[model samples]
Target chain A: MTAGAGADAGVVVGVDIGGTKVLAGVVDAGGRVTSTARRTTPGRRVVASQVEDALVEAILESAGGRHLAGVGVAAAGFVDSAGERVMFAPHLPWQGEPLRDLLEDRLGCPVLLDNDANCAARAEAHHGAARGAASALMITMGTGIGGAVLLDGHVLRGANGMAGEFGHMQVVPGGRSCECGRSGCWEQYSSGNALVRDARALMADQPSVLTDMSDGHPDRVTGPMVTTAAEAGDLVARAAFASVGDWLGVGTANLVAALDPEVVVIGGVSAAGDRLLDPARTSLQRTLVGVGHRAVPRLVAAELGPEAGMVGAALLVGGDGTRTAAP
Target chain B: MTAGAGADAGVVVGVDIGGTKVLAGVVDAGGRVTSTARRTTPGRRVVASQVEDALVEAILESAGGRHLAGVGVAAAGFVDSAGERVMFAPHLPWQGEPLRDLLEDRLGCPVLLDNDANCAARAEAHHGAARGAASALMITMGTGIGGAVLLDGHVLRGANGMAGEFGHMQVVPGGRSCECGRSGCWEQYSSGNALVRDARALMADQPSVLTDMSDGHPDRVTGPMVTTAAEAGDLVARAAFASVGDWLGVGTANLVAALDPEVVVIGGVSAAGDRLLDPARTSLQRTLVGVGHRAVPRLVAAELGPEAGMVGAALLVGGDGTRTAAP
Candidate 1:
């Protein structure tokens, strides 16, 4: 089936469930979000029912009496190959949860669940920076690095649908410890969290505008604050960005060596446009194997922003023709 | 067309061109080598015509007057996407030479050219360790690391045929100098060359059987000698194998994080069974991302051994229905 199908008679509901927020939208076949709704995600300590309640509310508000063809949930977790269950979600209350069936039952429509990064990659391949490319690598650098690979216009969801976890590839031996019980993961040096961590360390040692922005509490410095400070010409903030971008390039080089995609699209909060991509481009060229002899894949910023995940989810449900069976 | 076709009527010749040796074989549709021939690769300083002559001689000897359907050349170099010219071969005297057309003219049959690693990976997917796997990553650890990826049985050749140069991926920040003009490439720590390098370094500092095996010259220690010594319970030799295997595992972990294949097939000389893979297995588990939560791809040794490249090349020509057009 063609991608982003159902452009004429039907609309799909796309819900993006993150750790702190849930964003839902009614997307038509053309990838247009006609209606949107947002809700604060309940804390992880809350019951699974509470989280489900938040998702249901967001979908209901977004649907707003529209005839829905299918519903897609872009979740921040490990989605199973069948798109029926969430095996684990670090920040959400999901462990072997049948999220797809529950949503289908509640909404009375077909539902498909997928990792947010995969959804975003599909979105980019269908309508954004990676459009028309034979293959692409999409990296969403938020709190940590999340990745998705599109090969021949299909998401390469490994054997267990857990492929493209590029962040955890160890770059340094016995270096920075990670929550996944590993050290020197690419994310430790290149993600949004890495940017803030480096910025805070720089703040501790040097005088910078970040100290004032964080109100003298370096611990309170978030990723966005550092980006803001860097844009204002803060040396420490810019240095942190440079460090992260360098590591991003190193990791991209490793990916290119392995996958050899036609283009690499950087998304999520760290897409900081030229701030992150310029240094990444330089480092990627410097570190890439056979740089002088080989054709270097284009490195570009993602065209779609945060809304990419929701739109991609909607498209996947509408296009792949995999709808929930009737209750 | 199905892979390894033409089992009933015509046979194909597969030729593997390496730095030191050229191996050619007559392969039937069942992936069996009926007749084989070998020759010394002319030194790189020799003219390109001499190298081509050596390959043609091997093919003629292997064909033995049998009706040939096609001939496939698996060269150790950067082959372009069209499989007609060799962009650059490190150890061969070829630069943008139209090897395919030249071979077809001499052989009076169809000809196809491809990277040696891609040929080997294709062989495994069709007839060996990676058979039946939905996706597989093949790592050939000879003097250096060569890699190939197969998805749904087709080799992922990337935009250019230069996608599988896994040896050049920098694993260390500034560790060992590589022939590719890079530092700390995976090959520096993990290939057959790495094993010999480590053995020599150990022989320099410590008393070991390798010194005696090399006739008191540490520089003369070869990869096979070290492997044989390690099999004989030599500590230094075992340590070298362990070191190479650990790096192999680390590189495998990086590949898994990006590709997430169902199985990883280790081929080439270093597929010395458990000597390399046992240590690789331990390190792969230790370095793999989401170790406990995600399914660990089974790691297995290649089934076809050194003959895989030749066999795969024959299969590529016999299958895919792409042959040199009759002039």
Candidate 2:
């Protein structure tokens, strides 16, 4: 085979299944995405079959008659060390299912699977936030928190490929119980859920300006709503964001203390702008040990946005797994 | 150079200096220690000259008349990334001193410097607890705490080479003020100091048996004393250890969540058999975020003990940095 052909021979179809939608694309050599398609994620009822059908259709559309290679899927939850099974996913229907083999069989190609956060970090390391970084960590603060680590330009997949669960790190004991069955996990304090929780809690106690905006419906307070109200000079909404920012800083500080990453890339819906980041940056520095004396990692927002998982999934599918997995 | 010699050519002298003693040895290929010697660490009264002379003698003795290579000295505190200097060491006399050059001139050999905890981790990764492991963290819970990370068998020396300062991570906000001027650092709640703090606090508040044993002299109730009291079934001492264990588990859980290490090695004086480790292991498992479902990294006591630094330093001095540094 020609050098270029051999290099591109492993083109894998990448699929990113998020809570709200499924995005699929063909990723080839040099980390390029070909044809792409998107569809809403099916409801819990008949979700498995619906997701599979949507993924298959997306894969077919993305191939567009081109020579297909393998398939790579990035979703939430713990993936096996082999990157061929979904042991458990909080957001998806899959639990201890051999997803890779099933997808490979349907697509007529080999398949690999990984945590979505890991895929995002891989994508960033290869082409985005961590393009030329020596060591970096990407943390997505959304509905739930997701995280990825890239060391020496390579993703650090732990023994079980369950690495980069940065959101679940315990920030405080007996604080708040998470859906993951753990209390005071970093995500419960820094994620979209945490933001909404904070805003709702504040609105419940104090008669705030957001009350008029929400028409006295406390349940209507969402992450974006809090951000908007904060920007519009709402005291309770701003305090909620600041509290989440403090937790975010605490989480980042803990990560830095452990890994000493050269850079930390913040992503997900929470990274809408400087509204959440300013407080996060200040708190990260304030909480960091030896803040002034050491070369603390630079905290920057992710540039690739929602597409990071898609690109990263493509790379994971197209490239050899050796580069992504730690030695 | 012959193949065998090429792999082992950089035989740098390595020394592990601690509060109570100093250890020096000749490290060869494959992390073997050839000549070894130890001496009581001189006090601050006759600091610089005494320490320098001791170091020079150790290096010459360890060499055993072989053509000497460079030196790798591992000490405490925020070690300057440069192979030639120490920025600040709280326990030691020097500050921003050209230690490498001074040692080089004294012995006419190039020298490399690192934090002693990092040296211990290198030793463990190369030959002890974390051997054959791809990703792990080594924590020395001594009079204070020290930390190091091994990802894919490589040490993560952050942008400034001071990456693994884990003991400084905040476990509790406004809990306890550390010597580093930070309040509620992990070390304050989980190290030897933590044990002492817990014991002292317990003795003062509760009518513990230790009050009778030490007769209200908190200084007399050392870590070993607490261990002895616990072994004899002293409830308060056991409770104190349990508290430390919980914090230990918390700190380690934080580390695992942040770094996703495949193994965690607990070293230091406090890890004297099962007194500390039993609770540590239980607490670690309980506090771990995805404990039962994921490939949980092993939490085991270190086998190398105080000798780890010397052994690891020998390994560092003997081999090219590529294997451990670049993996």
Candidate 3:
């Protein structure tokens, strides 16, 4: 493959450290991935160092002897404002760990750290659906909802680097209990987990294609399974999507009321294209405050898909392929 | 009275055009009010020119023959990003009017316009409770829950200069209907109207001191009357404060999750010291997401009280009293 601009100088590594897996890729200045590597994440039960080791292995495999300039780690957790530590990651084993320093020390290169959702938002703003939008709110509907706010083409990292934790915003008072130890969080009713939970609950009450897909076991139902069934025209699966999409719309309306973004980009694996978005648009229009008077934000699906996090993380490090100042 | 440093150069007239009244003051560089004036706001039923006339009267009366450099109008409405038009004000007569140019021409001076809540937030950030806060979420609990987000000592006006419309955020899924045509907005449950609504509903069921305060008419019950009765240890009135405070806390928690501000300042007329704040604090602590893990923002009462909007508006004009570009 022909090298892109700045590829001859040095390539930067971008790592998306999620709960289930670690995906790393060597990205050039133009956001092109030159090489990639992936591995299963060591579960939270293991020592934190084990997870760090996995990240190192993925980076090394992806680099493939390329001159490394810096590394950007997009983690699914609260990265401190200094971009030096992972304050906490519920699904990962990190609590006030100096991950940035550790990685920089081991990799022999400068390392930048950020929340995964923020990385995805940066990627979308720079190269995907939210490009050219003055302000955008990106919601990633994975195992739970993860959100990032972009204004003037930059991520709005609040007092702490913990801004854009939209999933935890209470949409339903005293509704479902969230793993974050909250009740009625937007994610509890609108995320991948929510879809699975709704589908499983419905399967228990009424027969659905999801039950057969999960081998007639309600407990075995998954988010993607429901999406697959919905794609095949399953009535119960479609209803589950409708329920989650409604909650998503409710939360989006709240964000719109507060942020007034020009657009909202729905990302993550469970977005399921039009199946989730169609209902979300209907509900958002119905529930938006000042519906007739105010400008409604355009809601669209994310273009970069799963690779957005890594691509964004790589871009966050300066154009020269070195660590940049915190956003 | 001795004139402040820049007072002799030229003073800026700051006008706070609220729903009930027009409060105008001549302010110096050090944020001191040299002279002040107030006029009853012509209700929304009147033509837009009548309201503009009231603002003019207030400014001219407050000028006190001082060498005026410019004027800043802080209105209880959505000012456009260009600081020109008032999009919509629930309690005012303005509707897509070119208020800034009209006022500038009429007064023969450069004029800046902004939302009252944004002005209050700026004042708080510069000279009040949120003075040293890195980021602050200021909630003004008056006729409704007007809010502004301050970052790095500057107001974060979103894409359309309508970022701080926090009152319209849906706190209740299918609760009370709001005038904005949305159901269960935060303001609908936690505003001055909500406080009075709760107190009046309680008055119908039980005897209270408010009956004597409001001449035994539930319709006549005001926010201050409820505060007075609650201070007098009336159970129903105190319960009303508790209910409103709880919703306030719930919304604050949601804001905390989304913005993670360093501080949250409760302002406006209905936030009567500890009466409303005590229960709000309790609810904020109880409902805050990631309660044990995350850093909880300091919640406090506004220091400047009602005059904040006027002072902040005057400051927005410029350091030298000329109208600066829109914030």
Best by lDDT: 1
**Residue B18 shift from truth in candidate 3, angstroms:** 1.4
Residue B314, model 3: lDDT of 82
Misplaced by over 4 Å in model 3 are A1-9, A204-207, A269-271, B1-9, B269-271
Per-residue lDDT for B1-327 in model 1, tens only?
232445444568899999999999988778898899999999789999999999999999997877677888899998988888998998999999999999989988788889899999988998999999999999998889998988877788887667777898888888899987878899999998999999999888888998888899988999889988998999999999899999999999999988889999999744368888999999999999878888899999999988998988887674534563210
Residues B1-327, model 2: lDDT tens digits:
000024245455678876667788876555666678777777556667687787777777776666566667777656776545677766566667777778878877556667788888887887788988888988888877788888655677777677888888877767789887778888888888788789888887777777777877877788877887888888888888888877888878777866677899988843455677777788778877787787667888887776778766555453442222322
- Model 2 chain B is weakest, by summed lDDT over 10 consecutive residues, at B1-10
- Model 1 earns a TM-score of 0.95
lDDT of 3: 0.85
Give TM per candidate: 0.95, 0.91, 0.95
Model 3: lDDT of residue A307 = 86
lDDT of 1 by residue, A186-233 (tens): 999999999999999998999999999889999999988988899999
Interface residue Cα RMSD of candidate 1 after superposition: 1.0
Give the count of colliding residue pairs in each prediction.
Answer: 0, 2, 0
Q: Candidate 2 at B124: error in angstroms?
A: 1.4
Judged by TM-score, which candidate is best? 1
Tell me the DockQ of each model, to 2 decimals: 0.75, 0.66, 0.67
